[model samples]
Target: MRFVAKRQKEGVNVSDTHPLVEASTLIVGLAAIFAIIAVALIFVVELALYFVSAEDEANLFGDWLPDDLITVAPNDERLYQTQLLVDRLASHWPGAPYTFRVEIDDSEIANAMALPGGLIIVTQGLLNQVESENELAFVLGHELGHFRNRDHIRALGRGIVLSMFFAVVTGNDAAGIGIKAADITLRGFSRRQETRADEFGLGLVHSEYGHVDESWRLFERWNIDGSSFLDLVTYLSTHPETGDRIADMKRHAELERWPVDGEITDLSW
Candidate 1:
């Protein structure tokens, strides 16, 4: 008994590692290692997006989506007109491997998004905000640029890896992480992606309509008056500034000899 006490006091004969402690340490180590890996994956995907074109990437995610999430645009006159506009404008963009599919979202968010494999969603609030078909066409053209360059897939992968990092830190409960990533992914594109989309859309609109100035008018029409602090999210967080974007559009139109002012396309608004 005395010998045991002595040994215990010395701690030389005792096991230094407790089972609970070892387990917790292992979990922490794994979380850290995996977090690094996940971060690396995000960077890898960002780089990979440069080489991969739209035709090469295919996503069947729509099949897994429930009917409630996606509503096929009804045969309403507005939808018919929107579809006609999309089809006519899309014709000007070449080498599109997947046939474009447009659907209406029931949400009130004044926004749009592109998914992998030629999927596009336009929200109810977005439709309500557009003053004319030309404005809507600009919005559509931007989303199409996302599809054409496969920005959607790159963004999705980036979001997933980031969410994984969140899950690891949250002990695998990353619902908040998922929500944040979704908000970021859906609301705005990366600076490079956004610039590319703008270039694509502005060029397409110019090519199709002959006037590019009013394309920036959509920016003006999106009123943030009486908006809460949260309303500045897209403006503050990841997106390029709206003023800068309008200026860029003007400069680009000037460079391309694209019309900033000319006979504006007549839309039956």
Candidate 2:
């Protein structure tokens, strides 16, 4: 009887958890499992990227990227600015193995990106938004860092893998859907990766311009137009928060005793 009573007590205790508590526990466990999976996948991507050459990654995906940049004339002001930035920013990268290129897309989204094959695309909106060439240098150098670390290629591989997996699971998305998925995925990266790129960019800016001024203005102005909670979250999830970036940048500048304030060179033709 004592043994039976003890067994019953143990079973009762096991079932005593509130329904809500059990539900919460299940949710947390699933979330943890998902987090672990995501981290593992990113680690795998990082390892794969280490072995893949930047040029090869570029060649694999370079042919398919939507080249809206090709529409603008080579001498167009935005295009010219992009070319000059490539020369000013990318030239300083010593023993750089990959060829660097920049193109300007006619858009108001205020964005830029680097493709695997040393292609950098700057939007017209980004050109208009920046207050100075120094700001532009920071932006370009940040993208360049993506190339140096081959993060762009890692992102490219992730997108392709996910899109293919989704297609296999759903068996519904068409080829166009896959293409769009790739574009969307390329737009995001892990926050740690982005911060490293910022460091790379800021270091390059210091090397070239001898100082950084008004770097915060680049992000502040963009957010001023009202970065919504969702947009802010979405952007920050992959890139460090704007305030954090500015704060770190200032700390580095102070440590290096780099120039804090200087003349704002116009970002123009």
Candidate 3:
């Protein structure tokens, strides 16, 4: 009877703790549910911010240059030349939604920029510096390569998402986070993306002009002109460093077995 009583007491003790076990299980389940909800909310917020940023960029640039003004030319000859180059390159892509335009900024700063939605602007200074149609094609093709990969959009989206994340965590303003995010996005493109664009651009030049080497030659000329600072700024503000980019281009050229010739298109028209 004593032994039976001890066994019965042990069983009662275990039964008494069952409610605690159930409470613990309930707590864990609630925690898991909360975690999942938090993650889903974060993802939805990130996606929404990304699209918002893209729309904002589109609107900001739209105010300056409306969609109708895309084809407005500062000079007819330059516009015609730009159109020709864009057509040739677009043919290479075979279905890319690319619209090419030359925005003749009289700022005397030799620069070219590729924006989202296939908007490309080549400064008068840059146009005046190039020697041949092929060189121009190479440069324009690089910009087109950016467009095809949607780098601008990706960069903008990334910036927005990251900025929003930062702002949420740090309690900073949206505008402050945005500037930081943009700075981060432009420091370096994803290696895979950059390589893909480089190869695609190189192939376009090769297929069109039979000059696979033109891409590197153009960089070499830019390097010779002591444009490293501008290149650095571009890498920080728009793309990657020129030296690193050239190296990547060279690697791809070797992989594709493209011939190495010092022949460069003269831009001194």
Writing each residue's lDDT as its tens digit, candidate 1 over 118-224 gives: 77777776776677667888888888888776777777886777665565558545345444544454444376788788888888888788887578776764434
| Shift of residue 33 alpha carbon in model 2, Å | 2.5
Stretch of 10 with least lDDT, candidate 2: 173-182
lDDT by residue (tens digit), candidate 2, 132-156:
8888889889899898888777777
**Local accuracy by lDDT, each model:** 0.68, 0.70, 0.61
Rank the models by lDDT, top first.
2, 1, 3
Candidate 3 worst ten-residue window by lDDT: 63-72
Question: How many clashes in each structure?
Answer: 0, 0, 5
Off by over 4 Å in 2: 1-22, 58-64, 67-74, 158-189, 222-238
- TM-score, candidate 1, is 0.70
Task: Indicate the residue-level lDDT of 123 in model 3.
Answer: 68
Candidates in order, TM-scores: namely 0.70, 0.74, 0.61
